[model samples]
Target: MSNYKPIDAKREEFRKYLEHAGVMDALTKVLVSLYEETEKPEDALEYVRKHLGGITESSSNTDALRKELDESQAQVTELKAKLAKFETEAGNE
Candidate 1:
């Protein structure tokens, strides 16, 4: 039998969190674009910067983030209400 190791919970949580945030998808697209270049650009840093510079630059995206936060909070409130209803039904059953 082969030894099957369990995934670390924290790392898995973080990966899912990044995926939920679209960070992994964005980075994958940038890396794929870099890989498809026929000839590497003279300034490798510039090439990567051109493709990936905005990944961590949140200062310029504050309004977008605020909108997302508002939407997420609304979703949380909806889910919590659903959960509470389910719990009440379960208790009654």
Candidate 2:
């Protein structure tokens, strides 16, 4: 059986984040140029590994970034919920 798997959905999500964050477009341009010059996928991958090590260093960093953003959003949501609760309590008081 073929063992190929599709790209991770998270990768696309992160790629979108990078694009919005102004990293994906730059990486795409660099990787495309390298691919054209080398005519080799491995070479282009190596170029990305070396040149864009910031994003590829570890999954932890990616997870941490994602988690951090999520936590910040959660905090905002929790604060809003608490504020509403407090407002209700004060109204009752």
Q: What TM-scores do the predictions have?
A: 0.48, 0.39
Q: lDDT tens digits, residues 30-70, model 2?
A: 67766677455656567777557654457678789999999
User: In candidate 1, what residue range of length 10 has the lowest lDDT sum?
Assistant: 51-60
lDDT score, candidate 1: 0.86
Which residue pairs show backbone clashes in model 2?
A: none
Best candidate according to lDDT: 1
Overlapping backbone residue pairs in candidate 1 total 0
The local lDDT score (0 to 100) that residue 64 gets in candidate 2 is 94
Q: After superposition, how far is residue 74 of candidate 2 from its true place, in Å?
A: 1.3
Per-model CA lDDT versus the true structure: 0.86, 0.79
Over 6-74, each residue of candidate 1 has an lDDT whose tens digit, in order, gives 889999999999999988998898888878999878887787776786666765586788889999999
Number of clashing residue pairs in every model? 0, 0
Give RMSD to native, each candidate. Answer: 15.4, 13.0
Error of 1 at 5 (Å): 3.4
Evaluated at residue 77, the lDDT of candidate 2 is: 100
Q: Largest TM-score belongs to which candidate?
A: 1
